[model samples]
Target: MTQVPTGETVTAAEFRLFKTRSFSRHFNRTLHISVYEIHRDHSNRQPELTLLDHESIQAGDEGWLVFDVTAASNHWLLNAKYNAGLRLYVENDEGQSIDPSLAGILGRRAPRSKQPFMVTFFQANRNQIRSTRAVKQLKKRQQKKHSDLPHPNKLPGVFDHVHVPDGRQVCKRHELYVSFRDLGWLDWVIAPQGYSAFYCEGECSFPLDSCMNATNHAILQSLVHLMKPESVPKACCAPTKLSATSVLYYDNNNNVILKKHRNMVVKSCGCH
Candidate 1:
């Protein structure tokens, strides 16, 4: 078994020896080995090695293995390489070991470009009542409403919304309305009513309902559209009035207490 330095190029014989001897137990398995290199252009650099499925390699193939390296290194490459290793591990399949030089062999492979960020244009009625206090009060009410809602068993709650055009058709008070059902419950609730329009950009996950905002809502909506239908609610609407309240309740010692006391209810549920 040969021990190659991190940044150094791995030779064919060295890789074979490492595979057949030091890593013999991983013969029919996958090994996640990091390849480090100092490239003048990071974009052009390739992963030092990749585990090739046995099906892709011929029975007696002993030469260098090749792979079509994707141009982008951000997400696709990361996820592909990760899942490739996982597949190798879980399936316990024989595979060809590719050296970094294979990147040059598979030249001019079709470059995988990133999907463009979806741009949405909608008429947003800029609140004529730009009182910061009013906005803050509304925000506080929204927060209270969210806080009062039942907690979901899942970390993130997924929902769907109809993309409506802004104009006389929509109300002025709210920006968007999302309809979502709580976990273990079938009833769907309309959230933060009386909004103009909702733009769903991509998928997102969050722990708390109060955390749902324009950015996250868009992401969650996107994810719901992409992955799981059950995660998303049947529909969403724009509400007219903020259903949350912001009032500080304090004990004699001046300790702030949240108004909706779920802990007390849980303790008294008598489920023991």
Candidate 2:
């Protein structure tokens, strides 16, 4: 276990050591919350960061050097963990050393979900930006053409409507998931701002029968219509660009529809 003095300057080597620590749920008395880099998932091109309790502090080059506040004493633990501009100390587990202050939490908040919102993990390449640029670019183009993509910025009651805890906006995308449980009045749950889709799976009470994989614009619109007269498509829908790999066909009325073949899963809503 590493010990950080209350007030001191931490060396570069010390900061590296402070970061590689692990986490232990059972702290002797109090626990100071800190962040450490672990791994990133290549499938979804997102980072996988975890918290480090006081006991897990050891020598390694993976985390940040931050002030150690007893978990019991800090009434703002939840808030601090999620808020920006927390202090960091660079030093060994014990002994006097230099402490440096840094901006915000170490890495983005890890993705968390409400009950019944199980994690459907996605992988990302080691070089996330390079690996996921196409998907992001495609979505960006779509958003540009169709300005009415459902987003938190446009939605009046984003936090209230989806049951996201207040003050959790600072949390990272990976650290949050939206809830649709008992939301029967919702004809459409627009994908939160910036994300490509919003999920409503796992034994939900809402009418999400047709929206099993609501990834693209067409599926989302279909979901709105699926709700029928009760549907309240709060956000407007726009014509989506279908991929070349998909075969386009016309229905009995000659309405163009995308074949149910490729399931393009883009970024989904998270705490951020």
Candidate 3:
């Protein structure tokens, strides 16, 4: 494993939820959620690395996640000799775990051109709000601002971050537009295959909700692309049941706290 550079702060990456497609409205309006990592060091007996959650509510029709890698690197796990690794988890307002049916999440590493992670765009609403017209308009504006760019891919800028376009707290329509440039680079290691539920194949034109195997296959493409072309991790595995010794609690001030107990173990399917 490559050694991470030692410093007061290693690179801080943000995995923001660039896009989401929600076919099942299970968490539609009632969704108040948090995204965080269950990270671990690279030792043979990999120890658990813990971090707080990035909380967000659905602003409009779309749900967004803005996860900070700095929180995961507080203990300097980023500098470990063996590559540090983590898995993503989503929790609801009630603190119960929610499945990927809620939304197919697409995560982009900040400040790097690394491939995006775990997305199906299963029931993605493309034509309605995030139409080609809107995307092109945004892209054209972005190109004008960044004229010197070589290959012009759609990039997110300050203008696209507007939650409320017309100054309304809630709007009838909402859309998200982003590019690889906006999300820079990854600070820590990620095992792409473990996040199978969140990915979809590039050639997968069919939406497979009924067939679990096909569904997993489609989404597995997202994580697979995260890895190099020569190394694609396993696409299928039985979901592991996590046993947590600590629970996430909120103080009187609504601050999140990791309430600990005796023993804790964190496991992801890949990159252990």
Candidate 4:
């Protein structure tokens, strides 16, 4: 018989470890949990098999252990030469949280079902703009035929039908356009005058008067200009140059009218 250590004796069969890896080879994953208990001799001289926290398994760098029925037989006697009770938990690569579910699964209870959750994940890549070169080609073609652009007046007065969030009345149509200022990418056109609604397709929504307006329409145009047909939202079924005016305006007494006239002059002169 093998002599047990003074403080504890652990057999190889009581615990198991398993490992997984990231797709990019960036990280390694592992799981460790305890399986079963062992009885000691009638003298009770042996130490109990105290299962460490699940985090211990997660500490494995490359390989992990999975405790199966066969693995459970490998036991270490605590203090004495007999089998002992094993308690187990789970940990991740960081060995941070104690994963109880992982322990339960190892103990043979029904494993938790894996379900996909709905959340948007954003990844920033330096090459993202370069990857969108195809979109740029499409925009050039559209810009050359600017005369064919649809006039906003031709569209139905859908703005009247739009219900403002509050009892606010329809002020004026604020034209939203997409322009690439200093930024290499096209950004949403924000008006100095507040926006109450967005005129897209034939429907309109209210409360654009808030600080954070829906730039989705302008974003749709940029996407279309970039010829990224796939990125276009379904709500943006209107023509590329469709002019839907937002019915919201800021009233700084006479200052608003003077600003509007100044804008008209700038528009006529083709000034930026």
TM-scores vs. true structure, each candidate: 0.16, 0.19, 0.31, 0.18
Ten-residue region with minimum lDDT total, candidate 1:
263-272
- The 0-to-1 C-alpha lDDT of every candidate, in the order given, reads 0.25, 0.27, 0.34, 0.29
List candidate 2 stretches off by more than 4 Å. 1-59, 63-88, 101-272
User: Candidate 1: lDDT over CA atoms?
Assistant: 0.25
lDDT of 4 at 37: 47
Worst 10 residues of 2 by lDDT: 128-137
- TM value for model 3: 0.31
In Å, residue 238's CA in model 1 sits off its true spot by 8.4
> For candidate 2, lDDT tens digit of each residue in 1-272?
01212332222111111232333322221223343333333466644544333333323223333322233112222243432322222333343332221211223232221111100111223311110100011111112123344432222111212212222322111222323334441233222222233231222111112222223453344234322313433222221222222334456675766553443332332110
lDDT by residue for model 4 (30-130), tens: 54443444444236565444334333333233333433332223332223354344444444565544454323232233221111111111123321111
Clashes of each: 16, 30, 15, 25
Our tally of clashes for model 1 stands at 16
139-236 per-residue lDDT for model 3 (tens digits): 23323332232111222211122122123222111222322233441212121111112211212111111122223343344234322223554233
- For model 3, what is the alpha-carbon lDDT of residue 74? 44
**Models ranked on TM-score:** 3, 2, 4, 1
- lDDT agreement of model 2 with the native: 0.27
